[model samples]
Target: MKTAGGDAAAKRRAGERAAEEVEDGTVVGLGTGSTAAYAIEAIGDAVADGLEIRAIPTSFQSRQLALEVGIPLTTLDAVDRVDLAIDGADQVVDDPDATAHGTLIKGGGAAHSREKLVDAAADRFVVVADPSKLTARLDRSVPLEVLPDARTVAADRARVLGGEPTLRAAERKDGPVVTDNGNLVLDCDFGAIESPADLARDLSAIPGVLEHGLFVGLADATYVGTDDGVEIRAY
Candidate 1:
């Protein structure tokens, strides 16, 4: 089942199938974003079906979803390792967009911050998405998370990398936009990222940087959900 850009019901079903794939007693990493929302529900449904997995969330939102799904949950600090990461992507460059799978432009929902951490701790990062997000290359619209004080510096650094960094803004219920991590978001247009791994490493080496939206070696495989089904990618 594909969930990209689909209604909530499709997302829910797709997420359910992903969660169903997890083996019992595995420490699973949960991701954020609308597509992830389905995975969360699936995990919960699996729990309802008597499958028990320790889920580590990528964000507060994921944490809440864990609880909502009734999936036994723990934090990364509480767990030693993750066996699998079942999450969603925003854009996939390889195929058409659908509810089941595709390339993804993730982290728009602000789960990128912890998503990287979860992926690092995991043995595998199974990216779930629809086809529309797949593309010829990665880093079309990259997201960066930086220290509140060093946002500009980070932006400048991205510009140096041939990226156009723009502060992510939103109309808050009261005032400012609130990121999922309760921080700010910046969108960087790097056009086509040829070397995603190297660029991600460079960003991490910089100071005052928290985390970027880029997922480098962290991903073991990407699963795209198309109108037909899931397509798997790996290096």
Candidate 2:
């Protein structure tokens, strides 16, 4: 069946849940991207309605959005810990539990380096996505963050893993879009990652790999907003 307003509706449901999950005086890790943008706005609405919480953003974009939405801001350096981190994913899986895999492919906005760091600092990670993002297998859409000088080298290494690696599509004509940490990104196609953890490990072992957008079994659960309604998947 065709999903009605698929992406937009799914994002709205996820953002609503994210906003409802916060508590007074809570510390949260705000994520980046279009879906996370909604999550930020939902939290802001909550704040405007008297749900006060301090949010530490994972990227510059996130920070700005959070500010614009009226979510109180702080730095990870200033905050001791995050109660939870709400983010989005490019794809998920049929397994509701691992629907999106605790692991994820992020930095679609080129924030992988910092996003990874912030994720490492969070205690709980929640990924929100539309049902369409759920897949039976991971595929060509893998996003890889690499050092500029080692772009070709990294692409070659990814080929050793049975995938073709291409530079991430750049929106700007004058320059490749630089990540928040100054790294360049390559979108790789590994087809189906039988062992995402192993793949993530291999990629991480590479010298020039700043971070691969793969979550590698890091998520506890995912909330999928389907055409019918919201479904909770635990993994």
Candidate 3:
């Protein structure tokens, strides 16, 4: 079994590898989560070494980290286009038979809505992950950002789609978890997703659901951190 420290190191390796892809004089999309944090730090270090780039953060967490690392911040509306986006996935489907290998499920940090917006707008989107995140299929719980008043309706809709929807609860606080957009989150479990694209569309069409955590064709590549080194899979 891999130790916690080993997993962390693996995440760092993948994140830094993706960070190295960023070039000077370009706009980057900074992602959320622990793995993406390493990429943000690497970019910050690059900035300290005179790399000039503007970054659009996917969440409050990412924004704060960028500030601490000295990566210049910009808004999506302020930039003409995003050159590249680096993000972490909660689970990645690494199917060998498929043409591409970066099908992913994200939103563990409740930032998938903004992350999707930034990632989809970028010219290239790279995913960073450790070996533990890799799987033959995406069977993880899908996170849904729903309107505060429509939580029940959204859950019912998810259940109608043959999913078990549960309101995500805050760890340090009481009651359900609220997103950065002042919305509620529903984590729906649909065992062994047969078709991610179709499920994504179905969940998206539901009323009151602002966004769902099913990233289909957004990833251009994935850097999987291993004990030996980082494995790059192009999508």
Query: Quick one: best TM-score, which candidate?
Result: 3
Let me know the TM-score candidate 3 reaches against the reference structure: 0.96
lDDT of 2 by residue, 43-134 (tens): 89889999878988888989988888888898889988888888877766555444335557666677867776776778877777787667
Q: How well does model 3 score by local distance difference test? A: 0.92
Residue 61 miss distance in model 1 (angstroms)? 1.7
Residue-level lDDT tens digits of model 1 in 1-235: 3433645454454555576668888999988877677778777877898887788888887788778768888888888788998877666545223222223456677667788778777887777655555666675677777777788788888888888988777755654345665666678888877666667778777676677777654555665555545556763
In order, candidate lDDTs are: 0.70, 0.76, 0.92
Whole-model lDDT for model 1 versus the true structure? 0.70
| TM-score list, all predictions | 0.84, 0.90, 0.96
Lowest-sum lDDT 10-residue window in model 3? 1-10
* Maximum-lDDT candidate: 3
In candidate 1, stretches whose alpha carbon ends up further than 4 angstroms from where it belongs are 1-14, 93-105, 174-176, 180-182
Error of 3 at 138 (Å): 1.0
